[model samples]
Target: MVGLLLVVTLLTYIIPAGQYARDTAGNILTDDQFSYLDEQTPVSILDMLMLLMDGLIS
Candidate 1:
């Protein structure tokens, strides 16, 4: 029936039937954290805009 078919389709998506997807996401998150730690100084958008304006006006 339509209801049984819907249940089967939903189950297929909600199941973590593969390990590759999980491991890939974990690797990406770890890499992101490592890069964030490596950056010594981070610039804000406002600071960048101010610097650009100073360069242009001068």
Candidate 2:
């Protein structure tokens, strides 16, 4: 499981992040507003650990 997480983390760094502009209501993507995000926010190991612990409690 740890190995898979590491692989996914590496992949995230390699892949560029992106986002779509939402509509006025903020519930829909209006037209072709798809765009790359201004920055890359990769998942941290601590974040992953927190998620794992959250899953345990759930």
Candidate 3:
């Protein structure tokens, strides 16, 4: 359906960023330091879910 296609298109841009962040946490931020950044971050469960879907598409 059109909705699914739209979701897939959006996810394509999100998932990699999450993976990149997780992988580069040490380079970008330390563990406790990163936790503070995560709190300030606006990412939500829906955002995480979309990232997961994006991974599947990739």
Better of 1 and 2 by TM-score: 2
* Tens digits of lDDT, candidate 3, 1-58: 5477566656655644322334454566334433222222445557766876898899
Estimate, for each residue in 1-58, the C-alpha lDDT of model 2 and write its tens digit: 8899878877777889998899889999877887898889887778877878899999
Report every candidate's CA lDDT. 0.47, 0.85, 0.53
- Going through the candidates in the order shown, the clash numbers are 0, 0, 0
Winner by TM-score:
2
What are the runs in model 2 whose C-alpha is more than 4 Å off? 1-3
Candidate 3 residues lying further than 4 Å off, grouped into runs, are: 1-39
TM-score each candidate.
0.30, 0.63, 0.30
Clashing pairs in 2: none
Worst 10 residues of 2 by lDDT: 5-14
Model 1 alpha-carbon drift over 4 Å, by segment: 1-39
Model 2 has an lDDT value of 0.85
* Superior candidate under lDDT, 1 versus 3: 3
Q: What is the TM-score (0 to 1) of candidate 3?
A: 0.30
